[model samples]
Target chain A: MPEFEPKIVAFCCRYCAYTAADLAGSMRLQYSPNIRVVEMPCSGTIEHGLILNAFEKGVDGVYIAGCNLGDCHFLKGNVRAIKRVAAVKKILDEIGLGGQRLEFFHIPASEGTKFAKVANEMTERIRQLGPSPLNKNAAGNAQKEGGQTV
Target chain B: MIVAQQKPISEIAQMISDCKKVLFLGCAGCVTVCLSGGEKETDVLASAIRIKRTLENNPLEATTFTCTRQCDPEYIAGIDNLVKDVDAIVSLACGVGVQYLAERFMDKWVVPAMDTKFAGGSVVHGLWEEKCGLCGECILHRTGGICPIIRCSKSILNGPCGGSQYGKCEINKDIDCAWQLIYDRMKALGKLDKLMEIQPLKDWSKSRDGGPRKSIREDVMIDE
Candidate 1:
């Protein structure tokens, strides 16, 4: 939103957040372009590995947006997604990413403004956190932490 | 159910290194329903092992097979043809299944691919919490269905420990206070009268302390 452009990945449930993003576009609501949305059949489909892989591939922040908690198209799918995200957060915290980099939220398919807000909020949050520890300048240290040979 | 989790890929790869022909065994009982050592896990483990070996400059042949229930001999007999030519077996089952496979295929090396966790069930999908202590005895009739022996942070068989705070275990903020849950459930069912009844000291002999327990019934035995 300013001089700093933060990189982010948004995992959108095909039933909700993805449609919300499409609605946001139709409304011409301008938000950060930094977020690359990865659409899933259900947000519950996102696994712990996919989240870890995103950070490993250098994404500064990640979030999964799904149908509001009990409103999942496939009943209870959103609940599963929340549990998976919480589990991944534990691993992220253990690995010293501060655990705040991973997040999950719920929104209705019609809430276009909420989509924009979430985007702007995440982008701003990552900006304040600064370039990821995995950024080029400190990538060597991040690689060791990522358990990958850089 | 016997709870188990997948071992790290690298460590599993290391376990079956020298074997050229490997038999991948899957258990369809507890592990299949739990998604740990089921057909999917069996295939994944075999594929990962094959891929890792090829990538590490060691080409190996991998074959996969799943048993209806790996803990029983009748089900294991079905794998005779599957294990015929494989150099070794990597079992994606519980420790019981591994031993069963070893006993079944006495001549072949059967390796375990999962670390058995506990006797538990899922409170949420993909989350299996220990629900049963398998203590060879059950006392749920008196304390409501909640098993303090398994779900309680301290495994307390009585009432709430002083450490519980607001129905949460003091040992870990994430853990639910098991006795509190028991109390609430009992109260709701108009069964609080049972709490005052003292539970006797558990007979540890009924559990693993009994040393490799087994059961048999001549009436159910097969006859030729």
Candidate 2:
């Protein structure tokens, strides 16, 4: 049997987290290859339905990476994202998905090292939790696309 | 507009515990304006239910649709084919919408996902306050556009009732005295003399006390 490598989706804001991920790659930062990044104009635009849709699509875990407090390029984008993430977290727990499976990180544009650390942390956490219960064929399919970011 | 809040997901899940497929119906009228039962909320609810059922190893197939106004029979008629295969319907509209669905689709089990709260408008982005009492009468003309029936702690027509203090109601310090507002408005309009006149007893029969009421427009009715 193939090993279980959880698939994680990361919604990253272009002004901060997305750039930080890019810098992480340039800096030779070693982290788990389980993450699939979706770049957004601002994390505030992250809809609760979209995160829930990702879970329904069978992702093992999901996270939003936005700017640090008072650092959003759009003034309060990260602030808005934080409140939205909290609301979605509550909904996820209500739906029996375990709110811990979803997370939010405040990573500024220069925090390449922090971005790598978050990737490793989320990967290890999800690996211990195993694949999502929604994924019926998780054991058979998790390793099929181990390093793909789609 | 009617304001409502969505029921807890646990309660909603319990309602459909025995069903394998369901349709989530959202209303685009008052519920939509209140940010409770709209198209986006319908989709989110469907996803949540599907995820919950899948996690429990009893996968549920969910579909979503939004109507312009669920209270109207014409909009309900449009979804005849959509309800053909669903085991139950989860209505995200207010009580009226829920009843309409139940009446229109007698074979399907209809459940409400929101608790119909009150007839009011949004005070802020996410805050709603009850403004009207739905007393089956309009007395805004008499009270300077403020309502004493719903806003006052006690529905006294000639209010201030010895409970008003510092422009606030005696029930809670946070609530403004309704009669105070009426006085201020009337004073500003130079119509404070209106307050001196004694008001007669209200006709309670016009309100919900009279039982379920109906409005008919015979002139607009089509000849059969």
The two-chain DockQ for each candidate, comma-separated, is 0.05, 0.86
Interface RMSD (Cα, Å) for model 1: 9.1
lDDT of 1 by residue, B1-224 (tens): 99999787667767778889999899989998788898877865675555455545686788888899889999999889989998899998899999999998999988889999999888786788888888788888877888988888778887699988999999899998999999999999999989987767899898889898887899998899
Report the number of the highest-lDDT candidate: 2
Stretches of model 2 off by over 4 angstroms after superposition: A1-3, A141-150
DockQ, structure candidate 2 = 0.86
Error of 1 at A89 (Å): 17
Q: How big is the positional error of residue B182 in model 1, measured in Å on the Cα after superposition?
A: 1.9
Model 2: how far is A52 from its true place, Å?
Answer: 0.7
Cα RMSD of all models vs. native, in order, equals: 9.4, 1.8
